[model samples]
Target: MLNRMSDHRLAQLNIAALKAPLDDPALADFVALLDPINALAEASPGFVWRYVDENGADATAARPFGDDLIVNFSLWADRDSLWNFTYRSGHLDLLRRRREWFTRMAAAHQVMWWVPAGRIPTIEEAGERLALLRANGPSPEAFTFTDSYPPPSAPPTTAETGTPETATRAGAGLTPPRPASPSSS
Candidate 1:
């Protein structure tokens, strides 16, 4: 069992369904931004680790979910660190433009939980968390930005958690842009 108080970090795993094949020209812009944004995340204050594939690329083609889905699993110092890198960094720009290259997922596409500080989460573990979130909604075990929970040591309170209203307003600037017509080249 992992203990929250003993150097554990927050882990986030998000899966996105591609609107078009990554090589498609319509998604060129999104693909182009990957390197820079990933570099930014790695350099961010709270960043600990990010899953990379055999090609040493960001796990964009890793499809533990399916061939059309991509996974981004990373570890951060804490919730605030992840939040800052995600919302207060260049990552937000890509997030805002996601609809152009990714489909709107009807199910929960993102899930976050805590992990032992240096322990990286396996794809199976990430999948389990995503499933838990999809089936049970937000909980300390697995949650989202809108419905966050505190670490085990902290008391669970609305004030401490990121409620839907607050998350919506705070992340408004990062909302995905309107969908664009799919293109192959």
Candidate 2:
């Protein structure tokens, strides 16, 4: 499945905009849709990691900005894996019916970024990154596909002879850089 190829790791950040308080009785429906999709993804090939709440909840704090809006957050392995689950896999089936379960967002409600192979970013950090993208365009710390950034731990570097150990693949759909070595427990 898509997850297998995604074993290398990446992050797919997601946000869902909720409907007006008076109209948002579909929270149950939202969970129903996501729970299955999440299961499928976890079972998929490249499924390395995901972000969950303190109790290992499926969804974290549903930050309500107003009576009409709530923001949700999640992290995934890679853009391609997420893409498969989102647009090409069974999840897409629900996406086609999103209006029945979700509100029409006024802006781009989700963004994706590449994190180091095993890093599990916190929600606060995710929010900061999103805000940075909104406020400062793109840099190594926060960026988007249109103007990508490298993972903060390391960006492209060159040898003394200037032969880059890493090359700039920013904005070219490259996976985030992996650490020089894996961590030992």
Candidate 3:
């Protein structure tokens, strides 16, 4: 997946363990929001590309991890771009409600790495990157937003070292996911 990184883009993969089947009534609300949220990401600033299903829609049917899990894989122009879309957009709203639709995983469920520009990373490649991150923590090979590595050829800068998402997170007043009550569903 790394290919020739003379030019690169940020690749990220995040998996969620479903609390129930996609068609189950318990997941209806989550399903309903998929389209709109996906559209938002596509329209976000610095968005490069996203892995979609056969219909050019969201990646709901992608289960590279397991039958009970689904993935969201995409490329961003840079670390800051990904960080802004992830933490400063409407996407964060869904993240807060993750407990309602997904099970808490025992191990790392997200990873970010640099890939060659214009390269479309395969699901198998994503799996390997995630595995690498889980086993070795942050490295140039694989990492996360909180502990990211710069492009193999670029020097680190304040924007990468001291991400602006910190201020955005605090200003947004982000709170932890609360217990999902049956009545709220």
Candidate 4:
């Protein structure tokens, strides 16, 4: 049996196209919440690392993907850690209001993958994963919360049961209820 406590970490990259300039009055609310929300994430359990720009600011102005896009790239101990922080923490507040600040993307804008513990992925690598997901749909190499794959080191059978494990340990069969789509901001 696999150790199941693999030393791999889960990495996530999400991009959102901005509806207005960061300093624009239309975005004032979103901008104002950035620092507090980021602080909350840093203090959250299982928080590992987040991408910051040269000025030690959030990666909003990095523009690695496009001039109008902001990226959130981070790592966690496992999918459960990431899921908890994303859904069970203050992050959900922002996520609920995303359309107020971001354009509705026609394609997938988030991707998740596994990396060796302590390894940080580059922006280019994140972009590649997103591209792969868009082109190939979900795979073990790149996936989404709705269609996730297991970590490479996961055991074939559950530790508590001799039966084979058929679903991801994190999120399992729970799919988030998609909020009604609001027109792009």
Which has the greatest lDDT?
4
Give the winner by TM-score: 1 or 3.
Answer: 1
User: What lDDT does candidate 4 reach at residue 36?
Assistant: 88
Each model's Cα RMSD: 18.0, 10.3, 18.1, 14.5
Rank list by lDDT: 4, 1, 3, 2
Per-candidate TM vs. native?
A: 0.77, 0.62, 0.77, 0.80
Between candidates 1 and 4, which one is better according to TM-score?
4
Runs in model 4 lying further than 4 Å from the true structure: 154-185
In model 2, which range of ten residues has the least summed lDDT? Answer: 1-10
Question: Residue 132's C-alpha lDDT in candidate 2?
Answer: 69
lDDT-wise, the better of 2 and 4 is 4
Instruction: Decide which is better by lDDT, 1 or 2.
Output: 1
Error of 1 at 109 (Å): 0.4
CA RMSD (A), model 1: 18.0
lDDT of each residue in 1-39, candidate 2, tens digit only:
011122234554556655534234666666566667768
**Shift in Å, residue 185, candidate 1:** 91
